[model samples]
Target: MHQLLSRTFKPTFLKIYNESHLHNQKLGRETHFRVVIVSHEFNTISPVKRERLVHKSLEHELQAGVHALSVIARAVDEPLDTHTSPPCQKPVV
Candidate 1:
């Protein structure tokens, strides 16, 4: 996933936070992610378009096993948020 994003987005800053353990699941399982991407590629795009671009890059993982995914895609000059994320709604197994 990281490699894919790197190749596709060419972000100046990339952060992939694995939040799978915080969900309702067994320990050490990786199914959810919080990604912070800063890229010049996003400079001319809207927020929705940024999400679409990211989803397009990770389509197969979302279909295969990833239960929840959240992203903060920003342009190189944009500011990042420092607030906390809400609870995950992971599926019941």
Candidate 2:
């Protein structure tokens, strides 16, 4: 999958997380993953298009062992602020 994404998108920041451990039941193969891809290629593309590109790139992997995939694709210039938020303070009772 990493190879496919590298070849297809040439991402600046590509993080592939193997999340198969979260799944209790096995689904044929142990290939559940989460991909966080940051690239200039996605700057001009729509969200759906970005997902399609990923899916197209991993077509072979999808057929082979991969089952579930969660994709978080963004342009290289885009900051990952969404993943980090200010801590919430507890209210006094």
Candidate 3:
């Protein structure tokens, strides 16, 4: 997925997180992921389009393994405030 995004979006700041552990209690493949991508390509695009672009880039992964993806796409020049959120607790089965 990172490779696909790198080739297609050429992001300025890209962070791909494997959040599969969060869904460990669920019955399915461990394919959940979260992507935080900052790129110049997103400057003129809408949020929906940004997601579409990412989906398009990872078409194969979506078909093969990835079950859920949460994306945070931003423009290269955008100012993003950093904040630390609370850690996630393990899900009870």
RMSD of each: 2.7, 7.8, 3.9
Could you tell me which residue pairs clash in candidate 2?
none
Residue-wise lDDT of candidate 2 within 1-93, one digit each (tens)? Answer: 788798788888888877665664355446777788988899999889998888878888889877777788898777753242223345669
Across 1-93, the per-residue lDDT of candidate 3 in tens digits comes to 778899899988888877776665365446888888999999999979998889888889989988887788888787754333334577679
The candidate 2 region of ten consecutive residues with least summed lDDT is 81-90
* Residue 30, model 3, lDDT: 61
TM-score of each: 0.89, 0.77, 0.78
Error of 1 at 50 (Å): 0.3
**Alpha-carbon runs more than 4 Å astray in model 3:** 25-29, 81-93
Candidate 1 lDDT over 1-93, as tens digits, reads: 999999999999898888887887688888988888999999999989998899889999999999878989999888987345688666779
Superpose all Cα atoms of candidate 1 onto the true structure and report the RMSD in Å to 1 decimal: 2.7
Best by lDDT: 1
Give the top-scoring candidate (TM-score). 1
